[model samples]
Target chain A: MVDLNVFTTTTIYASVLALLSLGITLIYMTTRVFNFAHPRLSLVAAYAAATFMAIYARSAHLKPNLEPAETSIGYVTVPFPASFYLVGVVAATVFGVVAALVEYYAILKPLLRRGADYLKLMIATLAYDFILMAVLFLYNTHRAVKSALSNPLRLTPTSLSMTAYDVSIVTEGGTFIAGMFIFSAALAVALAAALYLLLYRTTLGVKMRASIENPPLAEVLGINVERIYAIAWILSGATAGLAGYIMLFATSAGSLKPISATSPADEIVVSAFAGSIVGGVNSIFGSIAGGLLIGYAETYVTQLLQAITGYPEMFQYARVVSMAIVALTLLFAPSGLAGLLRSPRARRLLSRIPVPGRARGGGR
Target chain B: MEEPIIVVDKVNAGYEKLQTLFDVSLEIPRGKITVIVGPNGAGKSTLLKTLFGLTKVYSGRITFEGRDITRLPPHERAKLGMAFIFQLNNVFAELTVKENLRLAGHDLPASVLEERIREVFETFPRLRERLDQKAGTMSGGERQMLAMAIGMIRKPKVFLIDEPTAGLAPKLAREVLENVRKLNEQGYTIVLVEQNVKAGLEIGDKGVLVVSGRIAFDGPAAELLARKDLAKMYLGIS
Candidate 1:
């Protein structure tokens, strides 16, 4: 029996990957044009974390970084011991919001104002990606040594390590399959639930959905589609920031090279696009499902291939396999996994079943 | 009695490079039903939509209630007490009729919203039977009525109805026309555009016959009816 430990590890990594992918999946679905700059937005967010770390390093006495709590799995413990986790979250969130505004002003707004070709906007994003990547490289290098405009980044190592149970989700014999399945599926399901509630259970979600469906129609109804778009961009930015942190944790890195260098976006942008498609791009729950499904397929498919074909090199080809799945899915199920999963009858049935406990978002 | 309820002076509007309305100018009386009747593509709907601030008015001036609203957004126009009932008459198809009414009547007193909806429903008992029904599932005739009722929920100063009787069977069309007449009599400044000349003239207090983006006849409904040749030339009828 092959040890499923690798699958367990990959599954955890995949869960975090799914969240990052969700953002890519989401904006792509609404705008329908691939935003090459999204992951770079992740890169930009890494800069934000760098800034946070810089500040934390400067502000001594309060343990600058949280020790990786061995028992904590789904969340990060603030390295600083001052018990100001909320402040750290806010600090990180503000950086995300700022980056979002920058993209909105620089890229999305001008294109929307002129009603520029979406394809052209997407193409223009390439230049922005290159620019940001160069900026990050310069910034990271300066942080490593010294730089102008930005105060030199300072990293002081702290001593707080989490145990195996804290960081690692160990899969033992016999119970490995069930344990790993529940763990992986749980993240995707929880994420899907939260996203569903946010998109369906909030007025902002209704307006956002309305804008996505028909911008001009929403405008006619007195909903400010332009403002909605800005908010959506900012929200997307915040989520991208979370995704950046997720990537940082997965690799256990404080130095922003793989992330800040723009490879973070490029690396998993395909997976995000794939996950988004696996879920209906428009449906919030759909994106999460898409992410989870891609995560499973990417991990399991590679393992399965490795198991069947005594070939070691096939593991490296997993991304290509993932991309191919996305391409094939797009070609056939263009509406995406949501399209395949949600037939009209299914929607009607779901509609009839009034959800319990949670508010209907029906309140005026 | 007062300044014209709505003013359009030398308005030129259309898609890029192709002008649909050419210096289309008209004055609509306050507190009266003003109907614009024309053949297909006479810019009847376009004129009303431009006045409602849908399509951009390239070179023209429009004033509503002593305020120059030449370049206001659709929602801003709504805030200025203006409303439009589209020909398609799409209510938020995803939402229920009640929710649709609630969104429209958001500007109203919170305490009386339910009572107001009930009163409006009593006016058209058809809606009373199906308050919770989704607008998408309703018949076209019922949809038009609900749409009209929705427009009134906000108590607009000037309500522009674009082809309310469109795509309905004759009996349903008559029902819708009667409802429009009833609403007008209930003290709403109504500007209507319709291709159904006879039905439009019947409900309309004043009718203007438009030809090729310009008004050819602007007078009482009876006068337009008596001058059959003028109506024929403008609307291509015998």
Candidate 2:
């Protein structure tokens, strides 16, 4: 029988991963640049939320009383104002937008105007990622020192837990359902729906799609391609911010430690990129599928292998699954799942492959 | 002579650091088909692109309807009632025919946009039937019709078309030229660059032969076609 707790935690993780992958795919479609700083953009939001929660906790006189709870989860602290979590969410989203716009205007736009090729533009994002990491490091250290010296409530500036702030429901069957799971799932669905409506139903969305398909042709048709691209960046940043904020709950549910300042850039970036690539970097919805596949596989596959092999240490190798999947995707379907489904040539190739029951048609 | 709708005054333009059109001057009269033909790499398409502000103008002035537009960007030029149809990749291949028309009239009011789409349907009824079909799946001739229909949706004052029949079969090429003539008869000024020199000049009101980015001859279409020496030496026509 599958463990309910593990399933809930895995679903939460998959929802957040889907949002992150969608942001990456949207940015790629608009700018045609692989933004290495994108994961750091999410980290910016995570740090922003953590900092906001700390400030709110201090102001509300909530003493940092860390104790072990009855549950399997490790640490528990005094809950702050429930409304204060909203403040954290807002702060995360705003900071994400500001950071992304900074990358676009300060770095990407200037390089593009100077006629930098894709390689230089991509390298510029890498440099920007390093810069963000340094900034985040210094800020987290300063906050840690300041909180240690002056504040009675001692929260780690680099890491955060959302358990205290999260509301949970105990099922009649004695199962615990984390609020994060519901919130993340609902938000991901809402975001996907909103994006679909915006892209298909609105004039600005049509203009954006047109610009993405052919910028020069769009320009001749009087569409401001630059403005559409800026809007895309705004959407990318917003989604990244939401993903970062919700990720804290997944961390709390699974490992009992909140995501650290370095976690997104160091660990989650690989899975996010793998999701986008395996889903088809050119498709928005495909990236979501990619994210879910990677997220579930990373958790459940590790659990299954560990159980079968009687080795508890197999969880550490979970990321290898993502790497393997990415390699297979690139080898067989470089354009990703969307191409296999949509492109006639790819479909033809698929039909040619000999299946046990399916009759093959003659080659054109 | 009728008043020229577009006047290129000694325009020297090309892509960055490459000067293709050198001190070239021309005038396109209103309500007439002006055909621009030349040998390979003679900057025929470049001249069309220059007229639509797509190329870098080192030093020159292009006046459209008595307004200077040499410094305007392509979008701004488009807003000034000029439509440029490229030789290839002119249509958004991923978009449906209706979506392409909607994007062409992006800034129009909803009612006006619908009205314009209806007008476009009147011109090319095939687009109405294939309203939901992806443009990339359409045949070459149908794609050209859709491109023209997209241009027509905006009701632009002038059409700068570059090799509309570039890759089509000969029969379809003739049909496309016939459609161009029909568009001209409907009172839209057209400046067309064509590789099929004979067919292009046959329907052209004015003929311009550009050789190595220079205007070798500019006159009535019949007069230019009657010149056997220029036709044999430049156009490889008997």
Best by TM-score: 2
How close to the true structure is residue A153 of candidate 2, measured as C-alpha lDDT? Answer: 38
Worst 10 residues of 1 chain B by lDDT: B102-111
Q: Candidate 1 DockQ score? A: 0.35
Residue pairs with clashing backbones, model 2 = none
Off by over 4 Å in 1: A1-17, A24-33, A61-79, A82-88, A143-198, A252-257, A344-364, B107-109
* Per-model i-RMS: 4.7, 6.1
Lowest summed lDDT across 10 adjacent residues in model 2 chain A is found at A71-80
User: How well does each candidate superpose onto the true structure, as a TM-score?
Assistant: 0.83, 0.88
Q: Please tell me which predicted candidate would have the highest DockQ against the true structure.
A: 2
Q: What lDDT tens digits, residue by residue, belong to model 2 across residues B1-238?
A: 7679999999999887789999999999999999999899999999999998888999989999999999988899899999999899999999988789988999888999999999888878888888877899899999999999989988999999999999899999999999999899889999999999999999999999999999999999888889999899989999
Residue-level lDDT of model 1, residues A120-151, one tens digit each, is: 87886677778777877766666342321133
